[model samples]
Target: MSRVGKKPIALPGGVKLQIGEELQVEGPKGKLLVPIPKGITIENKNGTVEVTRESDKYAALHGLTRALASNAIVGVSSGWTRELDIVGIGYRCDVKGNLATFTLGYSHSIEFLLPQGVDMTVDKQTHIVLKSHDRQLVGQVAAKMRALRPPDPYKNKGVRYTGEVLRKKVGKSGAGGKGK
Candidate 1:
């Protein structure tokens, strides 16, 4: 038995679940659908939801289905957030409506369009906050933003996640006098 699959997910207030070919989770924030794989079953008892697999052959999918369902419930109920910071002398970002303009030390500024489900806010032109009811969408948006100008190992400049630690690499100037 998969431990994660056997655990019951508590349905918070304002969240509703519809089980069929797929699981439809709706709440105050938004709605999400989790696909139900073969040999896996879900049941709602009282305010809790449980996932069970038909046999050990579906062990791997058991945990995955449970996690997806749990995330959907939580996402619709409370939402999700992903934060990023722009690090550099001139690196910054601005969000106007559904468009985001980024100055990531490139010759020309990069313009990114926010997806329908994701929302972004900029603070002091350096801090970026991404919010959405879909956890995967929020994470994907953040990753794409970070990829625009990944942090430099030597200068430590570019977009990075909040509280992310990076070990700065020593530049050529720090190398011993081999060129001298």
Candidate 2:
């Protein structure tokens, strides 16, 4: 028995969910499509959604599907957000319309094209806020942006998520090598 799968997903006002071959979620934020895998059945109740598995092998997917559906519902209703912070000298970011320009101490700035329905905002050039109704898209965009300049373990300089902690490495003491 999956506790999460057994739980009903409460539907908030303004958000409409259609359960079928795929989950169609629409709300103020935007529209999102969540694929319904085989062997999983969705039951729409009074202002709630439920999931059931067609076989025991799909037991794991039962909860996963339900969780993803819940996330989609909430995302479309209130949206999702991911934040990134630029570290090190000259590390910064700028958003222009649907594109984001980044300068992670590199010689040239990098430009990232944003997909539709996603919004990005930069604060103080170091803090970036990404917003999207689709949870997957938001996560993917954030991951791509972070991958542009992953934080280095040595210097801990690069792009990282806000509130993300990094384990900084300690430099070796001055000791001449070459067998002394």
The TM-score leader among the candidates is 1
Q: Which ten residues in a row have the lowest lDDT in candidate 2?
A: 171-180
Q: Among all windows of ten consecutive residues in candidate 1, which has the lowest summed lDDT?
A: 171-180
* The candidate that achieves the highest lDDT relative to the unseen native structure: 1
Candidate 2 local lDDT, residue 20: 76
TM-score of each: 0.96, 0.94
Off by over 4 Å in 1: 174-180
Model 1's alpha-carbon lDDT is: 0.94
